[model samples]
Target: MTWNFMCLILSLFLSQFVHSLNNNTTDSLDTCLQDFAFRTLIRHRPHTGNLYNAMLPANLSGMSVSIVRLRSRRLWNRGANFCNFHIPSRTIPVPHVKRLALVYHDFGNWSSHYYTVPGYSMITPVIGFKVFDASNMMSRSVKKLSLNTMGKPIVIRFSNSTLSDGMVSKARCAIFSSNGTLHLGEITLANVCFSQDQGHFSIVVPLKRKRGQWKLWAIGIVLGIGGFILIGYVVIASVKVLKAKKIQVMEKQADEDLVLDTIWVGRSKMPSATVTRTQPTLEDGGLP
Candidate 1:
């Protein structure tokens, strides 16, 4: 039990340490990805309505990035749909520009490490997009833009989810807004999410039985088993003590009743003979 308590404390301490370290490290992840996206854009002559795949460095092998150049009028009229995101027809850039580039990315396996929904488990990859002004393609400093959905909501669809597997009833949409705030909402469609603005999006299932809180579950189990072992040891020690006391009491009684042989004659006591008789002593005037 004592050991288990120590282990639980240690786990909590390490959890905090790792969490703090993660926050520090992930703060630069977006900035680094943005630089790479811009490089990809300038490397190629991005044409309107054409989506081009961007390459990632070897260190980030499992991730993906894509960009689509579009005219603001076309976006307001027909909207833009690519890489699982659907911008509605009425949507327009908040600070309107003549042309814009929408950059899409998927964090692949690094999804959970960069973004997390505290009590839920992420089932699919983290995917999102950023809107950027592309008035001058050769320019270095392009301003980030936001969407005005114009009363219509943007939608994100996941191809990896199955609504028939009972996930539809349990899953909720998690939106990580541009300002790094979490917004959760119910999905009207089984495998879809709606949003007025952009950041990151994923579907998460509730941790009803602690499916996502593996650390807590592990600690509880360890403590429970350790307590059981401690109780067993106490019971065994108590039984051993009771038996030892009983044996001691029986030996004491036996010792008290134990007696050596003795002979009594005419109220005069004499030492008892053992295995041989003592020679009779006779009174004599002299040695005879």
Candidate 2:
């Protein structure tokens, strides 16, 4: 009876461990699928009005999957838009993704929807379906594509096939702000080659200047001007002071010279009168 009880207890522990492992696996797989969906949406920006059906293998139909539109205001574009999907979930309007994608999945479909995330400088939106089937499991892994915009504008240029074939094809261009908030739509390109081999595509996204940056520039200019004025005033005042000192010294020297000339003239008259009296005494010699 003792041996039987020990065996039963061991079996129960093993069973619990196995059950926990299965649950962990399922959770990890679900997280991977969500990441795959996000990456797919960002890479091939599809029109927002369309639907995307995930293509899964025959065995994974039981997985529950759904795409939820998460919105929040944060540092990106100063809380004017919500484009970042990787922000922490603790913030208000919590992010739908709880963690970064540790695994990569690829969807075979190429079409997707694009909606503009607000507060960007251009018409930039997180591209994904408004709704998806979360009721079933994903059979195959989704491919991971590069979708990074570190507060930088993405430039997408579309060229016609004829232009690539070395023919004169008319192409149109548009500009968006770095945050993808505003869209400067449908600009006509001049001198564009429509050749089939010479496709011309260029995206000129304008950089956004922050309000604080403008304020800093204005402050620097004002300080620079003020400093220059102050330095000029100091120099001018010094020059005037030096000139006044020089003039004062010159006037003092001139007065001293005038006083010396008057004393020399008075001494010369006294010497002449003394010489006349001595000559008369010598000529008389009366006592001799």
Candidate 3:
């Protein structure tokens, strides 16, 4: 009877332990599902259409973006009319996003969802005119131009859902402070040139470049190359001087040895009686 009671207690304890393990496993699975659901919602969700309501998700961080490339409307342009993303007002809208990437495929189409994650701002829309056609090569030619009387550098954020997936080949953005003329950091364009199969991507974050910047870069290169050559010349000249000094020392040593040798031969060949007779005594007592 006592043995039976002990067995019953042991069984109950084992059952409790198994139940606890099952509960833990179920909790872990639930947490994973919740995270997956959040990510999915972000990727598939659309931005609310309003110019004033630009925002980022509460879980994500925000950053500033700049115009790397700008496009303008022109005659025979094949790209779609400027795809406008209305920034909302009052509340900042968080953009639903997964990743930040630029992709290209064989299909001849531009992707509207160029930026991923939070934060989009369009300080100025594309303006101006350039004559171009809508072909593969021409598709790459239309560039964005400045918007509004070159007004105070516009600083604003853009939300996703500004355009459709296939309409936009590439997108660029820029930010400026209230003062129109003063510039901030280098502007960066998310998409530079989009090709059907591939595209030209910038290795560095694109910075705003003025027309004069090219000339400055050219001058810098020339100076750098010239400086490098000058340093090389100095090093070579130093080495040559060192080598000449070494040779001169060696020659001097040789001359001294030869003189010693001649003196020694003279001493050895002198007659034995006359060899030591000329030894000087106390400087020959010249001063005293």
Q: Which candidate is the best by TM-score?
A: 1
Tally clashing residue pairs in candidate 2: 43
Give the higher-lDDT candidate: 2 or 3.
2
Evaluated at residue 280, the lDDT of candidate 1 is 65
Runs in model 2 deviating more than 4 A are 1-119, 122-127, 130-234, 253-288
For TM-score, candidate 1 versus 2, the one ahead is 1
lDDT of 2 by residue, 173-268 (tens): 222222223232333333221111111122223445566988899999999999999999999999999999999999999867753322246446
Q: List the global CA lDDT of all models.
A: 0.78, 0.33, 0.29
List ranges where model 1 is wrong by over 4 Å: 1-27, 162-165, 208-288
Superposition error at 272 for model 1 (Å): 18
Minimum summed lDDT over a 10-residue window in model 1 is located at 3-12
TM-score of 2: 0.24
Ranking by lDDT: 1, 2, 3
Tens digit of lDDT per residue, candidate 3, span 1-288?
A: 353344345434433443343334323322222223223333444222111111222221221111111122211122222222111122110121111111111100111112111233332222111111112221323221112212222222222324333323333332211122212233233222221111111111222446898899999999999999999999999999999999999999986775322234544753222334565557767643
- Total colliding residue pairs, candidate 1: 0
Question: Estimated TM-score per prediction?
Answer: 0.67, 0.24, 0.24
lDDT of 3 at 161: 26
In terms of lDDT, model 2 sits at 0.33
Steric overlap count per candidate: 0, 43, 29
